[model samples]
Target: MRRIVQFSTGNVGRHSLRAVIGRPDLELVGVHASSPAKIGRDAAELCDWSEPTGVIATDDIDALIGLRPDCVVYTALAETRPMEALEQLTQILAAGINVVGTSFVWLAAPRYAGDWVREPLEKACAAGGSSLYINGVDPGYSGDTLVHTALSLATRVDSITVQEIFDYANYDDAEYTGAAMGFGVAEDEELPPLFLPGVVESMWGGPVRALADGLGIVLDEVRQRTERWFTPERIDCTMMTVLPGQMAAVRFAAEGVLDGEPVITVEHVNRLTAAAAPGWIFPPDGHVGVHRVVIEGDPRVEINTHVSHPLLDPTDAACISTAARVVNAIEWVCNAPNGIIAVEDIPQAAIMNGLMWRAK
Candidate 1:
């Protein structure tokens, strides 16, 4: 069993912790926490296990490094502290420990991260002969691996579009929803950072390029289009209320153009509820969130995937999938050549270990 330390138990990190505990081949050697209150707690307690696992959580980075685990599953938030995450990953790699992380998401394809982030990371990897693999749901499997795998069935390809359609009424992170994504705000106000020009392309374009490269096509240009819908009447939501004429939903599309046409495209359709936009795509019955890939070719293929459990709804399943995508790849990543790697280079992510599904 490979010794592993989990970092920052957040939305995705918590599930990563669960995955580490569930996998018999991975041993939990340490748990790194940013919160002072979380220090001195048992890893099993942090994960809500009925009994202790002998490994206690700590705030000391040196303590974790001292253990010298084979790999570090760094699931810290990149959107908030990208520089810090980069520095931490660099330090971890320089210590000769391979990494599988959800941070620095653009590192899902390292080259697209520009020279600044990639340069230091590559230096650290080379210095220690350690490799790093970054991934998540949308940026990880939905757009890159899932699309590329589905494309294999097509004899001739016209275009490929990967879509994420969800009703986010139950999604509680008001700060992230309103401030970062510009949801429930006045449409006339300046759009949030995510909707601003070049932001989505900067963050998500790497996956598009990764998928395009799989098809051996070079995108001449990458473009973005955004459209928003407004609420007609005040509606109460678990997170926030959508008042009359307020921002209700948004559609954002990033297209990779080749020969003056979009060959690879990724679209996100998020609604406050089904009523927000009746015309827009919503998950079929028995699902609330759907990650879909559509290939228009000789043998057209459209794959809709939804992760669900008895206790977890579609939204929770989405978060778990994000964590599980990279968590399940830790072994393959640690065994790969020393460098920054992508999903296409790694083995298939096997996530069917403990979760059961409802087939309809």
Candidate 2:
């Protein structure tokens, strides 16, 4: 079993914490939380378990580094704190812990990560002989990995389009929905950070690049397309609300062009409510979220994936899937060569232990 330290217990990290405790192949050495109230709490209590884990949460970053576990699941908020997150990742990598998580979005495809961000991590990896892999549900398992896996059956490929169509009603993060993505803004308001120039390319473009690289297609350029919608009436969700004429939904496509055509693309149809975007795709079961991949070629194909559980909504279920993606990849990443790695660089990433077995 590999010794591990979890960096945060936020939206994604909370699920990661549960996964670590249940994963028999991993031993939780320490857990780091930023909130003062969370400090000194038992890891078991933090995850809602009855049993007590001796591990006590700490606010001290230096103390986490001191534990020196074999791996660190750095699921702290990166988009909200890129510079600080980068600095923290740099310190952790330099300390030689094999790191994996969704903190560094661009590391999903390090080749596209800007030098200012990628260079320091690369240098740290070289100096410490460590490896880092960064990915999550949207740009991760459901987008890039799913597309890559679906392409194996294609005889010839022309265009690959991956889409995430989901209602944000259950995702109760007002700051993320209203401010970050402009889910509840006035119709006359300017584009929010979610649609701001370069943000899409910076975040979703890595998946496009990864798909193109997998298919051996050289993209001539990358482009963005966006459409915004306002609610016809007041829209109420689990934690937030959007008044009439507010930005209720946004559909944006990030495309990677090859020979004047978009060969690889990632599109998001995000909304405050399911009824907000009728023209966009939706799963038959009407789950809160669904990720779709369309491959146009000799054998035309379309596939949709919905990940959820009895106790979790589609939003939290998606988070759990994202956590499982990284947790399951822990062993492969730790054993990999010192550098940044992506999903394609590793094997099938089957769940560890005897959770799933094949018949001889």
Candidate 3:
């Protein structure tokens, strides 16, 4: 069994911790929590498990590194703290431990993440002979993994689009929903970081570039577009409140253009509530989150993936899926050669383990 260190105890991190503790092939070694209350608590308490696993959460990175886990499942909030997260990942890599997590959003496609983000991780990995694999539901599977998987059936490919249609009100992060996503903002206010120029390219462009690379096509440019819808009535979610006339829904896309045509595109349609954006796209269920991949070619392929959980909301259930994307890849990441290992590097057979059989 590979020893694992779970980083952070946020929405995604909590699920990662549970996956590590529940899996028979994985041993929970250490947990890194940023919150003061969670730092000294048992891992079970953080994830709602009734029994303790003899593992406690700590904020000391050095202490966790000293544990020498085979891999660290990093689910920290990277969207707001990209540089800090990257630095921590490098530190973990330099300590000679493999890392598989959802923190590094841009690292999902390193070539487009720019040198500032890629160089440090490369140096650290080479220095300590460690490896890092970053993946998530949208940037991880929906965009690159699932999109590519569906493209396999296309005889002639024209354009590819991956859309994440979800209600963000269910996502329980006030700062993320308010500041980062620009939800509940006035019409005259400035655009939020997510919609600002170059931000979309920096975050979602990874999949666009990866798709371009996979198709053996060089994109002339990666462009971004965003639009918002205002809520006519006040609405409240688990995290923040959206007042009347505040921005409630957003539709944005990172497009890979070749000869002025968008060949590969990543689009996101998010609403504070399902009722906010009736005109925009929604899943067949028309209730929660769904990732749709559409390929326009001779034999067009369109797949809508609806992720759910018995005890969790659709937004949180997607987090569990995101954690699984990286957690399940721990073994492959640990066994691979040291460096920033991409999804293409890991074989499908190795990554598909545990899905067919349930462990008692």
The TM-scores, one per candidate, come to 0.92, 0.94, 0.96
lDDT score, residue 96, model 3?
93
Residue 204, candidate 2: C-alpha displacement in angstroms? 1.0
Q: How far off is residue 21 in model 1, in Å?
A: 1.6
Candidate 2 wrong stretches, greater than 4 Å: 349-360
Candidate 3 TM-score, C-alpha based: 0.96
Residue-wise C-alpha lDDT for candidate 1, range 287-342, written one tens digit per residue: 67889999999899999888887876567678888887777777777788999987
Output the TM-score of candidate 2: 0.94
Q: On residues 1-360, what C-alpha lDDT tens digit does candidate 3 reach at each position?
A: 898999998989998888888887889999999989898899999998768988999999999999989999998898788789988999999999999989778888766678988899999999999998988887878887789789998998999989998887778887764587788898888878887788888889888988888889999999998998999899888757889888988888899999998899899988887778889877775568789899999799998898887878989999889998888888888889988877778887797775543532
Q: After superposition, how far is residue 126 of candidate 3 from its true place, in Å?
A: 0.5
Taken over the whole model, the C-alpha lDDT of each candidate is: 0.81, 0.82, 0.86
Candidate 2 residue-wise lDDT, 149-220, digit = tens:
678778998899899988888886776546778877886788788878888888888778777777777889
lDDT of 3 at 159: 96
Off by over 4 Å in 1: 349-360
Clashes of 3: 0
